[model samples]
Target: MSGHSKWHNIQKTKGAADAKRSAAFTKIAKEIIVAVKQGGSGDPANNSRLATVIAKAKAANMPNDNIKRTIDKALGAGNTDNYESVTYEGYGPCGVAVIVEALTDNRQRTAPEIRHYFDKFGKGMGAQGCVSWSFDRKGVIVISNEDEELDEDTVMMDALDSGAEDFSADGPVFEITTDPDAFNDVVAALEKKGYTFESAELEMVPQNYVTMTGEDDVKNMEKLLDMLDDNEDVQNVWHNWQQD
Candidate 1:
């Protein structure tokens, strides 16, 4: 696995123990709202974006009732909150490229708050596309090996047959990659075969990674990520920091 992929796995492990469950739920809820509005439907059957978000929520162990409630609320007449997708690019400590994806009702407030973290914990915020050009958007599906029931070769073949571009094992997880447009289709194919994911989402994959070893740089990078993760508007954060 690549360094960023490893770092992603580490963060997933840490997130479970992190005292940000409520914040996580809030972020997922906002995602549901955005997916519904953007896809022009609240039903996952017709909304691929919403289905992807629902899958992500389930991977996070979000309760079924909570997920249903979120969808119902989004479809309800009383829910009128409008969110727009926004992305910010920047360099974090030790010059690690960072990308943040957010859904916000107020970019005026969200932009400044994000810039504050970049200024405090990173070098500073960069202009749009400054760092984004160095990344490619890809569909990523993560499957856990905790159950010990998965056969590596079988899984690999299944993923390949289902439209995955690449597959690799990272310790206890299998990371599957696909073209962004084929993400939902591959995910659905896997689901039909009774496979579940640890996490699945479209993510920014860095073309090149930056490795940070200095103590201060690593600390600052962690702090910056935590701050971004805690922000409800912030849905996903990607970086090229190769942890050592």
Candidate 2:
């Protein structure tokens, strides 16, 4: 979870930079478009994926108009271009493993571009299952435990009751995981209990982590991961690089 926290920090720093705001919006919009398509409905109330993405976009202070426009495009019958969700697995500099989840209208165009980025960074993409075996699909939800609103034990008990598989502390928040089908119920239960979180979304958790001992190696690895994250087709990037 520390590695995930560090990665989130890096993304936050990059997103805050003035030069990256446009890029951030593009990425967020793409996610909304894809989420609407995947969820099969434009209304967030009926579409869990769209609801989660809307929450994330709202957190970033993205304009409501922009969000509505994107959703309308997704629902519009005139739209023809179709995007497919794909995951790419690979190892980064210093041998850190990575998984890149993308939503692209053209895999033919996206695959080559993604491969090139890795090749240029002295890292190479792996076959379908090469690095995927290291990760397990899980529902990850982040919730605030501030104001002593929910003690750890109380939260843990409720989470387990709601079908959560595991729980951990990620910085000042709790990271809860559950079976994919149980995600909605777990989150709803937590919310009903008055826990307000910064963010909640599904994620891939690595079964094992590759630790970097040398500072130089860690720096290089970070640069490579950052480059992978900037791709337009990419939605989320996951890795197993423990960070303190």
Q: Give one digit per residue, the lDDT tens place, for model 1 in 87-131.
A: 999989878899999998899999999999999999999999999
Query: How would you encode candidate 2's per-residue C-alpha lDDT over 1-244 as one tens digit per residue?
Result: 1224533334443454336767777888888888888899999879988877876666455789999999999888897757788988888766677888998988999999878866766368888888878788777776665555567778778778877888776556676777776777777777777765555666777887777788777776766667766677887777777765
Per the 3 Å backbone cut-off, how many clashing residue pairs does candidate 2 have? 0
List per-prediction Cα lDDT, in the order shown: 0.84, 0.73
Runs of candidate 2 exceeding 4 Å displacement? 1-22, 44-48, 51-68, 145-150
Candidate 2 TM-score, true structure as reference? 0.80
**Cα lDDT, model 2, residue 4:** 40
Q: For candidate 2, give the lDDT.
A: 0.73
Which of the numbered candidates is closest to the native, going by highest TM-score?
A: 1
TM-score of 1: 0.93
Clash pairs detected, candidate 2: none
